[model samples]
Target chain A: MSHTTLQKKKLIARVSRLKGQMEAVERALEAERPCGEILQLLASVRGALTGLTGEVLDDHLREHVLNAEDDAARAEAVEEISEVLRTYIR
Target chain B: MSHTTLQKKKLIARVSRLKGQMEAVERALEAERPCGEILQLLASVRGALTGLTGEVLDDHLREHVLNAEDDAARAEAVEEISEVLRTYIR
Candidate 1:
């Protein structure tokens, strides 16, 4: 199922923030900022993006995979989710 | 930089495949497949999803962040990317 309208709005807002972060990176480049400083900012932006990704991913898991009615299904979903999340988020 | 139309289409195709994998997971759940069996399928789906994520992330690093005009910028970008990639993927 899709997220509620409110959730969609929140997600869009997160995306907008990511866009802003991208612009910041661009500006820093134009300004010829120090490499160390630029790295710090980029790292911050990446962290936010990952956090957003994780939240959306968790929502999908709970809403779609976890709703399965059987024990076996739930267990399987949990395993896949754990594996993917562990591998993907890093 | 935005991808060329061809790249966008390719990415969409990958997303379509991901959609199919999700549906497959849903069908297995609906069919009451054994938990172990369903876990295998879900794990497969997650793996594919993670692979897709990694591909897109790598592209962004190469096309946007890594092209900085200076060595220092490159170094900083590399550090941030390495950290984020390690932290985000399993």
Candidate 2:
């Protein structure tokens, strides 16, 4: 039961099945489907929400950044993770 | 450039920087820093990666999933997505 409470119950059962696949992709766009089968169900819900955001960023980089210790707080936590990866690769 | 190309570029850049942070973390450990500092760096890295992942997922959802047309295709897509989510959350 540990392991972060089993990863928060598997991220709340995969976000409740991704909210039932976004309500079945809005009921296949109100039943007027076609566009390549709704873009393959929106690429399988964007690959299942990018695998649930990479499993919560790989469990926050293995339990808070690989078990940090110090050196200016790991260079200020890698410069605040490079400013959040430069604002998410913007 | 095309959106996909731009996304690729951003991903590459972010990954490269993440690599640098990894090296820095290693150095911090080698220097026998403190635990708190190291953890911070790791957290930052995780945040950055998560942001990047979200960006990609959002783009995919917008361009591929949300714009789909058909019914069965959409259903299949959603199912595939569910599978992915299950794997990741597990």
Candidate 3:
């Protein structure tokens, strides 16, 4: 299997957990929970997201950047990751 | 009503939408969609999250920092927000 396909199960699991966290935030807001609690939840979600992003990025670097078949392909891979990172960090 | 309470409905709406976006990512990953598509979805989710965080922070600034009753309270509010921001930006 391709590297990405191999990682699919784990990645999906992380996304499912993230969905649950988002749902909890929604429920907390609907129930008029305190701002402090809500902010705490948001912080946790943000952390989880960062973690997921890092994992995906690591995989991308391995499959695309590091394993590129040629210099041209490596450059393209670098640009793609750079573009995504630009959008992501903003 | 307090500022946070006043914004609860809108905030919840945003959270619900975020939940939906996250669900899409989960589905995409499960179906083994292309990595590019998954990254795009992830980026959009991240953007939505940043927007939500900004809205909550705005309300926090208005209700807690700007309208704080005294110097001590203001200091505490500043510290609280700073702590959250530090964790968030990490």
The numbered model that scores best in DockQ is 3
Q: Quantify all predictions' global Cα lDDT against the true fold.
A: 0.55, 0.50, 0.80
**Where is the poorest 10-residue window by lDDT in model 2 chain A?**
A1-10
- Candidate 1, CAPRI quality class derived from DockQ: incorrect
Write one digit per residue (lDDT tens) for candidate 1, span B20-75.
65455455545555433444554555566556556655655775466665787567
The alpha-carbon RMSD values of the candidates against the true structure, listed in the order shown, are 9.8, 12.9, 2.4
Candidate 1: clashing residue pairs, number:
11
TM-score of 1: 0.43
Encode model 2's per-residue lDDT on B1-90: one tens digit a residue.
222344544554564565455455455545545434444555554565455545544554554456545666456556644544464454
Ranking by DockQ: 3, 1, 2
Candidate 2 A-chain TM? 0.40
Q: How close is candidate 2 to the true structure, as a TM-score?
A: 0.43
Q: Can you list each candidate's DockQ?
A: 0.07, 0.05, 0.63
At residue B33, candidate 2 shows an lDDT of 51
Top model number, TM-score: 3
Model 2, position B48, has a per-residue lDDT of: 55
lDDT of 3 by residue, A4-38 (tens): 56788888888989989988888887787767678
